[model samples]
Target chain A: MLLSNLELVPGRRVVKHLGLVQGSTVRAKHVGKDLFAGLKNIIGGELKAYTELLKESREEAVERMVKQAESAGANAVLNIRFATSSITQGAAEILAYGTAVTLE
Target chain B: MDLILQNFDLLLFAVLFITGYVAGRWNERRHYASIRKREDEFAGILVFTNRFPPPSTTRVATVLVSGSAVISEDFFKGVVAGLYSFFGGRIRSYESLLDRARREAVLRMKEQARAQGAGMIINVKFQTFAIGGRRASSVKGVEMLAYGTALSPVGA
Candidate 1:
């Protein structure tokens, strides 16, 4: 599906407005990744494990939003936006939302 | 018992130094290489901007593309950090941690846009969060998020 944060597609025309669609997910860091993070703490560098956790969460949230848009019969999702928050010590929540529209 | 007690500090330093020099350095080099490779490969795809429509594209559709990275500090850095703390100067070890996180996040976002066949990215922004953030005596991790609107050309 075509996704964008723009209200309009420059070359295409929006023929139908399917309204809003959204998807969200909550995730917790795993022990293995946390262990790796702990090890890295001794040397000080990027935590690949936690990064993967958030990345996966984002994709999952977006995937759900896409599913919502598809159910609304939208060929594209527009004005896409994301929000993230640390819900607790080891967990986080990611939310993705957009307007679903049919373009011609 | 006396011998062991006398060399405890020495043994601790040796252990930290050995592990930090080997694993920490190895991971950093490998990660840098990976980041360099991906950045070069996606150079054309990233039209990083903060303006909408990403002028001069067919603009078939737009989607939000994002990447995130979280990294921790190694023990070797801690040793130097201790020195820097006393000298009252920049803590250089933490700089690379944040730098790598940002670069990695942006690179991932580009990869996402590429997967969707986006021709351009615009209105890019970054979000950062620290979990148990930078304190003198604790393990810390940071999250860097790179996001933007990805635009694809029409009929492509």
Candidate 2:
């Protein structure tokens, strides 16, 4: 399905508004990475652990959002957005939302 | 009698130490899992957006996170304890959630633009807010919002 951050897709036309669709998830990874990250802190470089962790979570969140949109029978999702929250010290939550719409 | 008392004290100390260690490790794992889940979800949604086009007209979208949605009791407690950590403790988690929500909202807008036969989205904006107050039995919610204008491509 087509997804965009803007109200409307630049090249397509919205024919109908299906409704609002969204997906969210919470995740946590092993703390060994955190310790490794701490050691890397001294070197002042990128934390590969966090980077991999972030990438994984992002994919999961999007999968959920797309599923929601698909359930709504929307050919496209408009005005898509993402959000994150830490329910705890090491855990994080990611949310994706958009307006499900049919395009012509 | 003195030896017996010392033994009892040692046993108590061991139990307490074990409990603390387990609790600490559990808490850390919980946090890591939540973070990873969120990150994966966000990345998946972005891939969809990148494959799509931007919007052409103004539109708004929002996503929300509620306390009831959290399953981990310890994580919930951590949120409560976080209040005392000068808000930094839980801020990272909240930020990640909000970021994912915002990105998804933008993607939705782009979808709208494509539907409208627009070329690009313009004037995008985001907003966030707390909808519920802290309560022992109540769930708090955070909302993520995005808005923008969809543009049509030239000579299309």
Candidate 3:
């Protein structure tokens, strides 16, 4: 599977529109991490907890998006994009979407 | 009685510190694990775009949350209080969390677009909400959403 944000790939040629594809995931980190993050606040620095979190969430969403594209039999996906929503205090939703197309 | 109160404070602080440390470590571990798993999943996929898509084009794709995520009440309250203590003033930890979530989501989407061979993404959008109950003084979980489209070149 291929994914991109631009409508067209730099060198490849799109042959057909494979239709729309998307992927999403809902995630919740353990509370114990939150407690450590709170302590980090006192020391003052980077919020490693949240950094790790967003990273993981982003990967999951991308994976799902790729799966969707593959299922659609798309040779590539163009103009990929991501969206996130907070479902609750500990949980978040990550979503990825793009246009599935065939490449010549 | 004074001694007892002092001891209680000490115990509370210890608990808070330990909890915080544990939470941070656990969060880090989970993050690494998730990344590894996703990388394995994406190993076969290709990406093309590295930046945001240019404006002035119709969106060809979109993604949505379509669900809910909840933070533990205890964790939410602790984060709020921790932020207050660190900042020494009113701070919107929840809002910050929402904003971070949105940004991260968009970044991931861009990554996906790049993998798929797109030059840009557009039509980005966001939404947020709090699940159930009235607004309380303590921190509560919030839901944030981000969406957009990945665009490839016209001919390709």
Per-prediction count of colliding residue pairs?
18, 111, 59
Write one digit per residue (lDDT tens) for candidate 1, span B56-85: 554365667777888776778767777898
Interface RMSD of 3: 9.6
Off by over 4 Å in 2: B1-156
Provide the overall lDDT of each model, using Cα atoms, as 2-decimal numbers. 0.79, 0.52, 0.55
RMSD of each: 3.9, 12.7, 10.3
User: In candidate 3 chain A, what residue range of length 10 has the lowest lDDT sum?
Assistant: A37-46
Best by lDDT: 1
Ranking of candidates on TM-score, top first: 1, 3, 2
Candidate 1, residues A18-75, lDDT tens digits: the string is 9999999999877777676776787766766677777788889999999999989999
Tally clashing residue pairs in candidate 3.
59
Q: What is the TM-score of chain B in candidate 1?
A: 0.85
Candidate 3 residue spans exceeding 4 A from truth: B1-156
Top TM-score model: 1
Global CA lDDT computed for model 2: 0.52
Residue B12's lDDT in candidate 1: 89
